[model samples]
Each structure stands twice: as structure tokens, then as C-alpha cells.
Target: MTPPKTIRAAAIQVEARVADIPWNIEHASRLVDEAVDRGAELVALPEFFTTCIVYDERVFGCSLPPENPALDMLKEKARRHRIHIGGSYLEMRDGDVYNTYVFVEPDGKVHRHDKDLPTMVENAFYVGGDDTGLMETSLGPVGAAVCWETVRTQTVKRLRGKVGLLMTGSHWWSEPGWNWARGYWQRFHAGNGRLMERTPRTFASLIGAPLLHAGHASVIEGGFLVLPGTRLTAPIRTQLMGETQVIDGEGRLLARRRYQEGAGVAVADLQLGAVQPRAESPPRFWIPKFSPMLYFQWYHQNAAGKSAYRWAKRTGRLRTWDDGRNARAAAERL
Candidate 1:
């Protein structure tokens, strides 16, 4: 077997507007251009980079086919730049909507992996996807885990010793009370912030490969409110934002663009040739704190809920993302 080759990689961080395809595509294209100018041979974009999220009725209306126009735009960018590009998008296949990652070769050939599971609020919008998450590229074997999927025990375990690089695209929400509290805790605790600052380091260490994490940095105005609680004196608007980070096989941070730093590109050299896959124990299952979302997900996957879901789809009653009011109501239903 041949050793993995060294590759210069870049992670682009940009805020995407929900349902705004043109603006998101433009910004992502410019960021990829910036990375290429910085001598990056591989560039990655954040999850749902083209259209952040739409949970209500819009989600059903906005799902894209495999050969959708958005993909054509991304493929063109990869071909124009002659660089490997990794990105995730919302896809509708058969009757399911998926959070899917696509790896575009310099020749514009695209490979894809669906997220194994959706996290928290995401379950209301996307159905889980099934793919190996592993791919062979000119740079060497590469793997991907999307947003919250990175925290799963089996997600990275499946790629261990099988890939030289692992690409993670995320849209981790950041705000004052909730998100800030978690990030603060993550500094002292290893298992606290799996969706954000810790994923690249954790995946790299466990998978024995370099990991590139591209995340959103721009804040979008939304009706998402952090209700007053014992932790906070008053309600605050929830903002979605995070850092773009990269780490090497030894779990060393190579580069990063923090939330405070605003939108930017992160570049680092992945020394795949030096990687030595180390043996590690399989991660144990983590029991998350109880939440209404989990119960809703479980119900929806059951036989009775499955029938209701199919009927809703057929009748167009599944449009939970029509507006802020409907969004909240839909979330409660799930």
C-alpha cells in the first residue's frame, strides 16, 4: 500500500442566509478563490452552505434532486479552480430529505455521503442519510462527517485507519447564553462541545488522520429566542456562528478562524505521509440529556407515526417551516 500524499487544504467560513441560494453560492465561490490564491489544493465549505436551513413547509418545497442546479454551480467552481472541493447540501431523494456531503475531484467527478443522523433541531428538517462516508482520492483515502454527525461514536470509528484526511462541515449555532456556556465548558471538559471547537481535534486523534472543519461565521437574524432561565436574566436572540478549524493526525491545531474574527478562510498543510494510524478503543455509547426532540424523533420513526408522516407528505401538511410561528409549532409537534 502507498503512503498518503501531503496536501494543502483550506476551510472556508461564511454566514449563509436561509433559502438565499445566490448570495450563499457567490460568497462560497469567492472564498474558494481566496483559498486557491493561498495555494490550497483542497477546499471545503460548511454544511448547508448554499441554504442554511428551512424547517417549515419550505423544506418540503426546497429539496433538490441529485442533479440539481446548485450542484452544477459547485462542480463548475471545482473545475474552474482545478482543486478538490468538499461541501454539503440539502438533497431530496425519493421521499426523504438528506444532509449530504459531496467531494468533487479536480476533474469535476463528485462523490457523496449522507449524514448518518440529524442533531437536535435538525431532525425536524432532515431525515438521516446512509453512506460509507469514506472515499478514495488522489490525495489518498478521505472521509467525512457532517455537523452534529461528527459527535457520533460510529461516525469516526468507521473511518479509523481507512483515511488520511477527514472533512467535517458544520453550522454550529453560537450565541450568548446557551452556546457560550457550552464553549466555555469545553475548554475544561473534553466531551462538552462536540459540534464545534472540539470535533476536528477529536476526530483527528481517533481516526488517525488530519481533519478540516469548515464552519459558519456570520450571524443571521432569526426568531430563535433563548428564553429566560436560571442561567440568564432575560431572553436573548440566538445566533448561529462558529470557527473554521483544522488539526493534524496528532490532534494538534494547525489553524483556526474564531467567531469573533468574523468570516475568513483557514489554510493548513496536511502531512498525510507522516500519519501513522494508532489503535484506539471503540467509543462507548453516550446517553444525551433528555429532550422533547428525542422523544419526537422516536415517535416519528414508529409504525403509527410513519403512516402519519407519509400521509402528511402526501397532503402537504408537513410544511412546518412556513414562518416563525409555524416553525415553533412544528418543532413542538415533532
Candidate 2:
């Protein structure tokens, strides 16, 4: 049988209560079941779906050498569902822990990608990942990013290549505008679009592939205030899982549904080839023609290079200085 040109991809979302391992597994698995039932061959889970927020439980007592419990469980889920199920995880290898996402196919084949650039908070918990962007599978090329990595210029450039569909798991948090109390959440939710609307649209606008941004929707410690003008004791962190949707190459929303926090699956058939070979469009982040060597020079001249720094230390590194000693020294030389 020939493979279908278009693929149905599903993005799974859950409320994700902290440290509820069995519950999180069950709920994410159920989403896979739903996606498969709807004829989806590809499915994606939220960033670190197995663990709650990184600060939640220290990755379940996992230390420098992290154990990949999530990968094993996800593999079981994929085998059971007879579909591809993937999620962010903590991976241990060679005595280093990383924030990684593992993909398990229906046939039990697993592919993994460690977050190439760990966010500030992530760097605290996990070391840097070895690779960036997506993972390829039998269905097609599926790319992934977590949280802030999706916004990086280079990573986003990499994601828009010959990849079939774009998927991302993020704890991308935003303060939902105004909240008065129990009754106030409705108003805040209503304003969420205005507050957190830029990036997701960018996902569709740039990739031309169906994208998913999964996040938690729960009250966190020191959450934002509900009352309009009252000061809250602590700042709470919360996330509302975004709905799965398809976008065409024109950056139009082909389909979108509500963000649900249950055993939920958002389904869309992606025909990636229909949007390519444009004759007159200027290059965005990931255009057909990309030059890394140009960036090598750009970074070398504009950004810090440790070797450059060391070399410049002896030669007097004087591009910009905070301590004023180097600048003052150069002024004296002049």
C-alpha cells in the first residue's frame, strides 16, 4: 500500500497536575488513543509531559544522571495505541542529564531530541542538548521545540526545512490580564488572546505546517492576583493548553479548536507540499536558501566567542566593556 500524501497529526493536551505520574501517563495515553481513532499517524505531547513544571518535584528525585522513565512509559503507550506518541522528558546518558523528548512509533521504534538550547530555568535543571529542532519518523519529518527554543532565530530557521509537520511542547506562560477572584477568571481568559497571541500565530506563519503548543492549565504557587487592584502574596504560574490547529502556507488558520485540559486530541490532516516552491516570496526565518557561514561571521564579529575573548584578552578585547577597565585602558593607549 502506498503511503498517504497528507498525514493526520494530533496534538495532545492535559491539565497536568504536578507529580501525578500515573495520572499524567493515563491522560496523555488517552489522547493518543483518540488521535489514532481519528486516523492520526502522528501525535505529540507537551514539553516534559511526564514531569510537572521543572520546579515541581526535581524530576521525581532524579539526580545528575537522570532516568528516562517517561520514555519507557511513552513507548508502552505508543505500542498500546498502535500510533506514534511523543513528549518531552528527562534523559540520562554518560552521566549527564538533559531535557529531552523521545518519540516512540507504533512498531516500538524510538527517536529522541534533547532541547538544543536549554532555557535559563532549564539550564539549571538539565545540561544543554546535543541537537536542535525536529525528529524524523516513518510518516514524515516531524520537528519539535520546547518553550523559548522555538523563538530562536537559528532554531526556527532549522524547523522550516523539508520537515512535514511542526510540533512544539512549551511551558510558555503568560499573565492572563485581570482577575478579581473565582468569578474573575472568565474575564482573564477572555483577554488571554490579546496577551499571548503573538508566538502561536508565528508558528503557523513561519512553518507552513500544523503546529501544537501544549501547556498546563492549573493554579500554580503564588499565582497572579484575582482581584483587580489588590496585591497578591505570591506570584502564581499557570498555563492553558492551546488548541491544535492547521495552517496553510499562506499563514491562514485552516482549523482551530478550544484549548482543552482533558484526555483531549486535536486532529488535522496536513498536506505540506501544497504550500511550497513560491515564486516571489521573500525569505523569512527558514527560507529555501539559507547560509550558515554568513552567520558564523555574524556571530564571530557581533557576539562573544570564548576563543575570541581569550585571544582578545591578550590583544585587548575592546568591542564593549561593562567593567570600564578595558575601555579605560584602551583610552589611555589612544
Candidate 3:
């Protein structure tokens, strides 16, 4: 079936707390209500809307079981508002955690896509998935992706010309703590900001599909690994790079909310259709060029994080969804 010529959609930007599930749910629900009030037929939330992803033990405790409250909220919201809704969350399946996106239709139909790869420190929490992000919905073909997946060439290669709409989210973050070499870090962040702002539109053009991108907007407190084999950690304070936005298949911006603007919803009428590709997929891995710092952090942290993940799993330090939820509930009563 052909999708409507145009549909109003919303991308929700949220200020989520690390390992705070109840607060995040309440905050995101309010934003979802705001989107519906503005006549959005479909609403998307940021990656890990239930809790911010960080290299902390509490973050592992935020993962949910397959049938959990976070997903229930999405389904309830979709049913209540008679609109499509979705976002990514950490899900535990087969004893491993995954960054999973769950999209729900009005009639209670559901679709899921696990992020293909974990980014940097995120590697410590979840394993990657192999499924294509494409889904056949009542509104036609829809695609889902999370964070760095939207910036990779392979993602475009898989979805280009195959979907009418691309729904994605990001948990992109700035460098942690700028105390040392402040000026250099300042310049680095500024450049990263420019790239974040351009990603949505550029990705739309490459995939030849209208895109909805939701993102997180808040500070994150966590620890960075000082080495690969030890538990020594350095304190890191960082902020999420929010670029919640909607853009056309031809790469025209329809609506946007920047990180500095705080939490909100970006609503717009999207012209949905698969159009002629505006840019060819490059023969490289990532679409955007990584700076030296980003390059080093990406490689180094990935190895370090993976090592930590293995240790956590073997030693039974990694919290299961049930274990985490019960612990949080018990704390609430205290």
C-alpha cells in the first residue's frame, strides 16, 4: 500500500538520567503527549530513552527483559493515541544485552531492530545484531536505526531505495571532561557539533527517504577506562549531542531541536516516499570522517569496553533485567 503523501511526525528530544528508569519514563511520556497534541501521527524517541548509556555498572542494571515496562509504555502510548511510537532501549535476551529499537503501531503490532554495532564505551553493555532495520508497516516500508548506525555507509546500503521512511535515534556524546587542554577540547567539541547537526539531512539524502531522528539532551556522569585490563577508572563528565530533527528524502530540513535548546519535540509534516538517491554510498565504513581524537577513542574504548564486558559476564557482575528492575523497585520503597 502507498503511504499517504504527507504525514505529521514528531521527534522527541529528552534529558534522560543515567539508570533512572521511572523518571525517564515519566519525562518521555509527557513529551510523547506533547507530540500527539501537536497532531503527530508518528512519534519517535531517542536511543536509550529509559536510561542514558554510560560506562557505569548502574547502566548495565538498566537493561529490560523482552516484556518490560519501557516497551509496555510505548505500546500503551501507541494504542492510546492511535499513533505510531518507538525508541531504543537496552534489552536482555539469551543472557546477552542488546540496544534494541521497538516500534509499535496503533493496533498493537510491533517491530524491533537491534543496533548493528555498539559505539565506544557502549560496547561494554550490549552485543551487536545482524538483522536489517527494514520493516513493513501499515504505512509502507519503514526503517529503524540507532546512533552511529545512522552515520555508517553500510546502513545506507541496506536501506536505500527500500524504505519510504527512516526512523532513527542517537545517544551521541561529547568528549568527557575538558579540564586538561581546555582550548583543544573546546575546538574538538565545536567541530563535532557541526557534524551532529548535519547528520540527519545528509543521511536522508543518502537513503532517499524522509527521516525522523530523536536524540538525548543532558549531561552524563560516568567513568572512562584508564587501561584495558584493570578496573581503574577516570571520572568523566559529558553531555549528549542532541539533534532531534525531521528531514525530507531530498535532504531538506523540516524541523529541528538543537542540544542547547534542551528537551522538546520537533514536529513537522513529512513528505514520505522513496525518491532518487541524492548521494552515492561511499566505499568506506563511516560516512563522516572521524577526527584523531574520535578515531583513537573509538578503537581504544571498544577494546577496553569489550574486555570489561567479558569480565562482568564471567564474574556475574552484569545485572539481568529482572535483577535490575527488582533492585530499583526495592530502592524506591526504602
Candidate 4:
């Protein structure tokens, strides 16, 4: 299919309250409204926007169906705003919970894709999805990768020949031991945005596709902000907070929103019809085609990895944060 000459795409970087299901839905809806007000025809939200990335019991306890109220609200918003909405939620399917990204069209049609690779510690709560492909939409062939999936080289390669618009969802967090002079703390604190700048551009250049990355910037301690009795009393640290970036087909920064910046929508105009070829010519060097480390991790995280995690939980290598929601039992049934 021929792509559009141009489209107003928006990356919504907002604060997500953990496990506050109804509130998160309302908050995301308001942001979608703001994006529509800014003339965005294609809007994308950060990863797990409906539930801040958390492994707490509440999230597992309240796993919702694909047609749950939160998604229903997004559908109504998409129809009313006459725009496309994309984001994810903790979804239950076939008696298993998967982190699923739902793409909603103006006509209320929904396309779903599960996160094929779950990040560290996420393997415990959600099962990884098996299929990966582009979604045919009004904006042309749109595709996405949730969180760390954007950094999986093979995953990005798969989308190269299949998509024109690459909309991503991510929740990058502050690394451990955040200080002024060491490691990610220094890079994130005073790098003039260079640290966070390189990722999306690299993905765009590699994929040869225009990309929009929507990310959460709020200070989420343990990726859980609203959880009871765990809220920190100190001021929220702002290190390693992720950015919302728009990289063009030719690997140029079209627009961006930095960490801890005032929340709202960051919009970019992309000429989808002008995107580069689906697959660029192969490089001269016969470098390894895939990351053995990542693929190994992916393999273990699927079925076998869950067993290892269960052992860790039993042996005390892992600590369980129970929010009194019977999440373990809920996950067991799934």
C-alpha cells in the first residue's frame, strides 16, 4: 500500500500511577485529548501506560481482558478524536497474562501485539508473545516494540521490511546507585541529552524507518509509584528517566522530550511516503546476525525461565512484594 505524504504523530510522555487502573485510564485519555487538540492524527503512549511497570500483586490481581474498560475508553477516545491510539496493558489471554500493546483506529478497530521479550524480572508476571508483525493502519504499515524490545537487534531487523512507521513504547528507569559522578547517573544528569539521544536514532538508521518512541518520565521507585506503604519520603530522583524521541527515516532527530520535562504531547511530522527502503543493503563485515546473549535470555525467559524464577522465589534468591492482592494465586491459575 502507498503511504501518506505526511502525518502528525504524537509521543505522549506522562506520569503513570502504578496499579491505579481507573485513574491511569483517565489520565491517558486526557493526554490523548491534548494530542488531538494539537492535530495529531497518530498518537502513541508509553509502555504499560495503563499500569506503571510493576511486579506487585495488585497488577497481577487485577489483570483485565482485551475488551476491558480501559481499552473501551481508548476506543471511544480514538473514535471521538478521529485519530489512532497505541499503547499497552496487562492483558489476560488463554489463561495466561501477557503484556499486550493495543493499536486502536479511528473506526474503533483494534490490533493487538504482545511483548515478545519481557525485560528483567518481568518474566515472572507475564508470558512472552510468539508472533511479531506490522499493523496495517490509516497511517500506513505501523509497527511497535515495547521497552527493551526496541534494543533487540533481531526484533528491529524483523520490522525493517515490514513497516513504515515504527512507534515504540518504553519505560527506562534510573540505574542503581544514582550519584553525580558515576555511571548512568552522570550520563543522564549532565550529558546534554546525548546519552538518551543515541538509542532511537540508532534504531531508525538500522531499520531505515521513521520512529516515534513514547516513554514514561515520572519518578517510579521500583516502577511502582502509587503502591501503598512503599512510597519514598525523599524527593523523587530524576536520573535515567526516559525520553520521547522522533527519529526520521534518515536517522535524524525530528523532535524529542527530555527527562522530567513538563508532561504533555511531543508531536512530529513524518513523510511516510518518503521513508527509505524497507531493508538497507547488508554491511560488508559478516558480523554475527544476532546477539547470542539476548537470544539465550529470551529462550530461558519463555517457559524454562519461569521455572527457574519459581525456584528463586522458593529459595529466597528473589523477594516477593505482595500487595495483598493474591497475585501469586492469580498468576498460578493463569
Candidate 5:
């Protein structure tokens, strides 16, 4: 079947709460309905739409089974509305967790693409996946990416010429909590926010495809890990960088909803086809230039979070919904 020249798409910005799967799913569902009402044939939700990810221990409780409520909800919505819909979530598979994106088609077909790498403190909760983010949907060949993946050159390498449309989302948060250096951090976050606002269009230009990017928008109060394997933590209050937007293949912004605008949907009619690249992809790993602080945090937090993850798995402390179900089944057999 030939792909449509234009389709109405929506990117949903959600103010998701940490470790609250049920509430987040409900909130996202309402927004999905709103998008559908506005004639969105394809709806994309933010990364971790089922539950917000943080450095707290509660993040361990956010992992769901392969056949979980979040997946079920997407399937139901797609079938009910006869439209395509998707989002990423923390999923447990074979005792390991991954940041998995699940896309559902109107005919009930499902496609999955796990994030290739975890970002910052996210390393503590999930492992990276190896699949190419490309999916051959009924609509066309589409690429799926999560959070920082959208800002990486490696992602461009994988899907640049193969995909006609790029569907991506983020859970990107503000700078760390250091009240003593609040002034510096505030300025830092402001600069990063401006960069994030340009990311969707910039990335679209690189991949030479239209893009639909969703994101989270909310103030989060949580703990920052002071040490890898201990309960020691520092209070962190931050906001999500919600740059929900729709951009064309030529890097033109069609629609956008900023974080300060709160939770909503950014909907637009997109010309779905491959186009000439507007910008050359840099040879570096990251597409954007990172400050010294961000560079340090990226490496340092990655190591710390990995150490914490090892400790949690070794101690059998990384509990997930599948674990609980297995325990219940065992008890019943006994």
C-alpha cells in the first residue's frame, strides 16, 4: 500500500508523577482521547509515560511485565480508535529491565524498539537494547527513539535514510539539585532549555524526515543518589523539559507546546516522506555541545548508576511486576 502524503499526528506532553503507573496511564489516556478528537491518526506519548523515572529507590518499583497495563492500554486505544499510538516504558524481561518503546497499529499489530542506551541515573534501572529503532508500519517505515537518543548521532546513523517519519519522546529534566549553586544551575537549565526547544527541528533536518516529539512537563521532587550502593541521598527538585513538537522533513516547526505551557497535545498535519537533509550530521557522538558540568555528570552518574544497578540485582532488590506475579503463582502451586 502506498503511504499517505500527509497525516495528522499528535505528540502528547504529560505531567507524569514518579512511580505512579496507574495515575500516569489515566492521565495519558485522557490526552490521547483529546488528540484523537482533533483528528490525529497517529499519537505519540512521552518516554516513561507509565511512570516518571528518577534516581530514587521507588524507580525500581516502576518496571512492568511485557504484558502489562501500559501495553494493554495502548493496544486498546489503537484498536478502539482505529489509529496508531505508542509510548516508551520501563519493562522487565528475563530478570532485566529495559526502556522499551511499544507502538501499536490500528489492526492490533505491535512493534517494539528498546532504547539503545540509558541516560544519566537511568543506568541504575535498565540496560541498553541492541535493536535498530526502525519499524515497517502499515503507514510507512517509521523510526522510534527515546529521550537523549534523539540528540545522538548514532541514532541518525541507524535511521537516517531508512525512515520516512521519526517518532520520538523525552523525559529530560532540569539540572541537579544544589541549592548552594542555585544561581549557576538556574542559568545552566535556562540555556539547556533553549537548546532542547531546537532539538526536534534540528534532528529532523539531520534525518531528513518529519518528526513527532513528545515529552514530560512537571516539577519533580525526588532524591539524588549520594553513593552507588547506599541509602544516602540528597534532595533534588527539578522540572521536566517539555518540548513537545511537530516538525517537517525540512526542519520547519509545524506545532509546539513548551514545558511552561503544561501538559497537552501538539498536533499538526505532516507531509510524510523522506526529504533532502538540511544539515550534516556531525562526526561526534552527541549532536549538541555539552557544558563541562553535563559532560562530568554523564560519565560520573553512568558509573554510579551502573554500580547501584549491580548491587540491586545482586541483592535481589530489583523487584518488578513480573516478580510479584511469579511469587503469587508459586504460592498457589505450593
Candidate 6:
């Protein structure tokens, strides 16, 4: 089979209002319209674009069924516009709520994925998403994951040969305070911060394809777009919010507009030449080099209390989970 081709990508660096679902949806819908205007077949919104940066119980309380008005609105938009919407939503399922991302196709059909890892802040409210890796879409075998979810969402092993396009949504929150420094340092030192951002780019490189990374960067931090495969042709391209960024398939930045705003656009000839593979080298991406098997084995051994507790609920006595908080309260009395 021939190698995968390069794909044009647009990352929306939006300013999502906190706790406003209707406005968030409208803003995201507007972004989608703008992306289509620029000829972007696949467009991505920031994480939780359907609602404000809803965290904790806020995400659950605002949650709705797939058929809810918000989602239905998106369906009609996708079908009418002929664009694929890439992002996650806070969804209610089986009385419980989940932070889920859906790849809504142009036909108005949809595929869903839940976040594998909930941030420390989110642990207080969300249950972990049990599934891992990517889900398929008409665009190609696509992978959908949320921020922080990239860490244990499955070491890039499950990534290979499964999907050609890596679409990740990040609802990363940070305040310029003590906790922000603490959390930022953790992802930076361990998760490779900006550098590790290339995990998807590297994956696209390995399988000889291009990545459409729509970084969940909005408001405070701005946003980014990577095109290692396309960089050789033109490192600089316009991005959402009137900004421009030159990013490597390895998620490295070659150039960018330091401070810009209000929607921008960029495009790459996705059919750009092949992203050659190493002749005699082992896979250089994060997953292959790290010995994922042994690492994950130890991960759960020292996992956080929240993760451990969730695990018990999924595998032990509480296996048949219930969402009605009243039911649990009643069980406690029994």
C-alpha cells in the first residue's frame, strides 16, 4: 500500500467563556464555518467547546444526551456544511456523565470516545473513561483523545496502523498561581510540556502521514498547529484567530505570531511529498522507546487513590455502577 498523505489542519485558538454552553456552542459553530470557508475538510474546536471550561460537577450538570439540542444542532451543522467536527462534549449516559469527544461526520453521523485520564482537578467530579486509543472516522482511521488523556491513553503502540489521523482535544486549565506552577511543571518535566506535544506529530511521521493537531489552546494561552511534513514546503501558515504558527510533525515550532487574536486561517498541500521513514532505525516516537508494557505495569501499582477507587468500581463489588446519587446514599444506609 502507498504511504499516508499530508492533511491540512486548523486549530481554533478561541476564548471560551466559562460556564456558558450556548455561547460556547455558537462560538465553536462559528469556527467550524470559518474553517469550511478556508477549505478545511476536518476542523477542530478546543476541548469542551460545547460548554465553558466546565470542570468538576459543572461538566456533569451541563451534560446532555447525544440527541440533546446542543449536539443535534452540531449534527445539522456538520451535515449542511460538509465538515467533520473534531472535539469532545460533556455527555450524560446511563444516568452518569462523561467527558466525551465525538467525531461528527459530514453525513451527520457520529462516533464517540471518552477521556482516558481525568486531570487531578477533574478527579473530584469525573469517573475515568475506560476505553483507550483512537476511534475510526470517514476521513481515515482517526484517533480522538482529550488532553491529559494522551499520557496513559495507550502508549503509542495501539496508535500504530490503527489510525492515519490523530485528532486530540485538550481542555487544559491553568491559573497563574501556585497550583498552576505545580501542575505545569509536572506535564512539562514528565509529559515533555511543549515538546511532548509532538507525540501525535511523531506518530504521523512514523506511519508516513501528516497530523491534523487542533491543540485545545484558547484564550489565556493562545493556540498552535504542527506540520513537520508540510514545513519543508512552507513552515509558516495562518491559523485560527488571525494567528500564525510553524510547527513540526514532532510538535516543534519553527515560527509563530507572538500575540494575535480574533480567528486566523492556514492551509497545507496535504498531498505533499512522502514523509520518509528511517531506513534502519527503531521507532523513535515516545511509545516505542519507552518500554510501555513495564511502565504501565508500575503505573497502576502507584496510581492515585482516585484511580484506584475507580478501578474497584469497574472491576469489583461495585461493578454494576449506578449514577443516582440517591441510590448510593440508600445503599449506605442499608
Q: How close is each model in CA RMSD to the real structure?
A: 7.6, 13.9, 1.8, 7.1, 2.4, 11.3
* lDDT by candidate, in order shown: 0.68, 0.54, 0.90, 0.67, 0.89, 0.50
TM-score each candidate: 0.77, 0.65, 0.96, 0.76, 0.95, 0.63
lDDT, residue 287, model 2: 23
lDDT of 5 by residue, 1-334 (tens): 2354898999999999988888899999999999999999989999999888777777776799889888888999999999898899999899899999989999889999999999988999999999999999887898998889988999999988678888899999888667788899989999989888999998999988999999999988877767755656688888899999999989999999999999999999998888878899998999999889889888877887888788778888687855655776999999
Question: Candidate 6 lDDT, tens digit per residue, 1-334?
Answer: 2345544556554556544567777777777677677776666655666654322223334555656656776687688877676677667667445778777888877888877665543442345677754665566666666665444425345554455556665554432223445665344333333333454454455443344444433443211112211111112111112122323343444333221344443444343222343222244432334434225423432234244335434543222112334456899999
Q: By summed lDDT, which 10 consecutive residues of candidate 3 come out lowest?
A: 319-328
Location of the lowest summed lDDT over 10 successive residues in candidate 6? 223-232
**Per-residue lDDT tens digits of candidate 3, residues 177-273?**
7599998988888998899999988898999899999999999998998788766789999989999999988989999999999999999999887
Report the C-alpha lDDT of model 2 over 250-312, residue by residue, as the tens digit: 555554544544446667775554234222223454323323533442343222222222333
Better model by TM-score: candidate 2 vs candidate 4: 4
Write the residue-wise lDDT of candidate 4 on 84-124 in tens digits: 88888777766566878889999988888898867754665
| lDDT digits (tens) for residues 49-111 of candidate 1 | 877652333444455678866688778877887888888977777767688899998787888
Candidate 1, TM-score vs. the true structure?
0.77
Tell me, by TM-score, which candidate is best. 3
Best by lDDT: 3
Q: Quote the lDDT for 217 in model 1.
A: 66
Q: How much is 83 displaced in model 5, in angstroms?
A: 0.8
**What is the full ranking by lDDT, best candidate first?**
3, 5, 1, 4, 2, 6
Off by over 4 Å in 6: 1-8, 54-57, 153-155, 178-193, 196-200, 203-208, 216-266, 271-334
Residue 300's lDDT within candidate 6 is 31
